[model samples]
Target: MIKNYIKLALKLMLRKKYYTALTLVGISFTIMIITVFASFVDQIIGANTPERNRSRMLLLDKVSIYRNGKSTDATPSVHFLQHLPKLESAETVSILKRNEFVSFLNGKTAGHVLQQTDENLWNIADFKFVEGKSYTTDDVKSGARVAVINEKTKEHFFNNEDAEGKSITIYGQAFKVIGVLKSAAAFSKLYGDVYVPYTTDMNLHTTEKAIEGTYSAIILSKSEDARKVRTELRSQMRKIGRNANGADSLKLYPFSSIEQFAKSSSSNDDEPEYGKTTIILLIVMVLFMLIPAISLINLNLSRIGERAEEIGVRKSFGATSGALVKQFIIENVIITLIGGLIGLGMSIYASKLLIQVINSFDPLFKMPTDTFIVSWPVFAFCLFSCLIFGLVSGAYPAWKMSRMNVIYALKGGNSL
Candidate 1:
């Protein structure tokens, strides 16, 4: 009996080929759009590292004073680096100074800036080495003119040749390339095409004798007790320096806190309106799925009306309403499951097309090479969503057809 229902469903679909094609296309297109956007958001948020550890901490100065009836733009001097209180739980401290606009190897261009950092900088963040090794404590102490170039810089300068051990003149000083870093995600916040020894680069560019006293410091904590340490650090800084009103003027942030700050402070130009955009997309997709599902339900109702005499014969021969509803549901599930498989194939092709478009924008913008292929979780999600839509849409018509009056249905005068 179940087999007969499937046969009838297939025959019905084939009889209305245009409607069946439209339904399949609608489901496939909606799934494609959702999957592509999901992959994109995953890539953006998971830019520097894996999604699970998407948190980082940032410290700032909280002091502000009013002058001439307006708030003054007072911030902690960059020289505050020298006064950073040593926390027992801190692993390493890295000093950074950005956007100095110094000259590179060629004298013709002099607009690039060095992102200065200490030797253990890579340990704090996941920095992949493509060539040579990262800086060491000795390099910092000796004020070595060594630098690390990112993949983009390598391609730009050296082209196809090896970038390591190459001497590049920056700000009229020659610096050796001791390392080359792999390309980072385009949307990453911690982006630098070139990294130089903090103290060394500072000495060459400025007349200052010691840069450790003036650079911004990042203190890395070894454990998850970041919040406690943050509180302690802020208290320590406040104890060392206070405003006129005796209020704490130091700011502290934990690893998780920084990410939230970044999200809120992000520019609205290209940012995804996660809440409204996702809700709107889901609503539109559901509506797209509904239209065809409604058509299928109407088709089923018409077929059941034509088979009213047969349904009456079955009821007279002892078929229960429950049995009839079950048969119809099973038939719809089979059709939906078949459509889902096709939709899965469509999703794969769509993912590939999306990857191509992204890569075409820039060579470094390739889809994640590791685990780039679709996973079982994605497949399962698509299948589950498809089944739910199928079941809900098919239920009403099946239930209505099953409740027909047997004697009246047998008389066959549009009983439904």
Candidate 2:
């Protein structure tokens, strides 16, 4: 029975070649646009290479100090780091201080962003090493002028030769190159040309009895331990506020995920924003899909109207309205499934084209490679959406045609 319906659907599609082509193109393009956009967004937030442990990591980049109800924002200070309470739930704790500075190589000056961090930063944030290894906590505490450079920096300064044990002058000081790392995501917070120890920077580790300065902390823990870690961090902040002058009201926002980080960065909220953005995106996609679906429905209604005589003949031959409705619905679903497959292909091709175009315009506009993928769940959602579009656009037209008066349909006149 399904086979007969599919054969008839194919024949009818072939008979109206122009309409079928138009419908497929419209549906496929719409799906392609949505899927590609979704893929890029997923890559930006869900990619697991740079922030490999992002799911189990929490970032505290900013601190808020309230004096007479006027709030001031700054990075956490060395004092805060020194006095921070022990977190029972965190497995690893790391701190970082990043700044842009000029480095001299072969009498050429180049600006590079440098991250000053401890050995814990290496264990918490996964950085792929091309050669050598990360600096140790002993190196950090002893104020060793050792550095780790990324692949780009290594290529630019050393002609991609062995970077280990080489010395590069940063900020008028020579630092031994101890490690070379693979390139990180362009948008990653940890991205830098040079990584060195925080203790090596006298400015960051000054003996200041303040709770606000230039420092960020990373907490790594299990997914289930996130709440407990946050709670302990907040308790510590409150304790610090009680003793610090003009900082009696202090707020610490620990971002557990990219979505939460974005929200906290944009506002003071601690709740995740991705869930809200997801709902908005779904609503928008549904609205976008509706336009093409409406067009398909109108085309189906016209085509079904032309088949009124066939319906009458089938009715005369004792065909049930339910069976006719089912047949037409199946035909629509077949068309939709085919369109969905075409759309999936188009989406993948378009994403590659888009990346090429952007990169051509600017070579430095490097997006993360091998990040975009149409995962199984996304593909399944696409097929499910196709089914919904088919049913919505097909059902009313099928029901309407099936209920036509037999005698009027036979006369080939408008039944309505």
Give Cα-based local distance difference scores for all models.
0.61, 0.78
Q: What is the lDDT of residue 67 in candidate 1?
A: 33
Q: Write model 1 residue lDDT over 243-337, tens digit each, in one string.
A: 42333344443333333333354443222234554566567657756776777677667767666887788789998999878767876776677
Model 1 C-alpha RMSD to native: 7.3
TM-score of each: 0.60, 0.77
Backbone clashes, each candidate? 0, 0
Query: Which candidate comes out best when scored by TM-score?
Result: 2
* Candidate 2 Cα errors over 4 Å, as ranges: 97-116, 125-135, 142-210, 258-278, 313-319, 352-365, 406-416
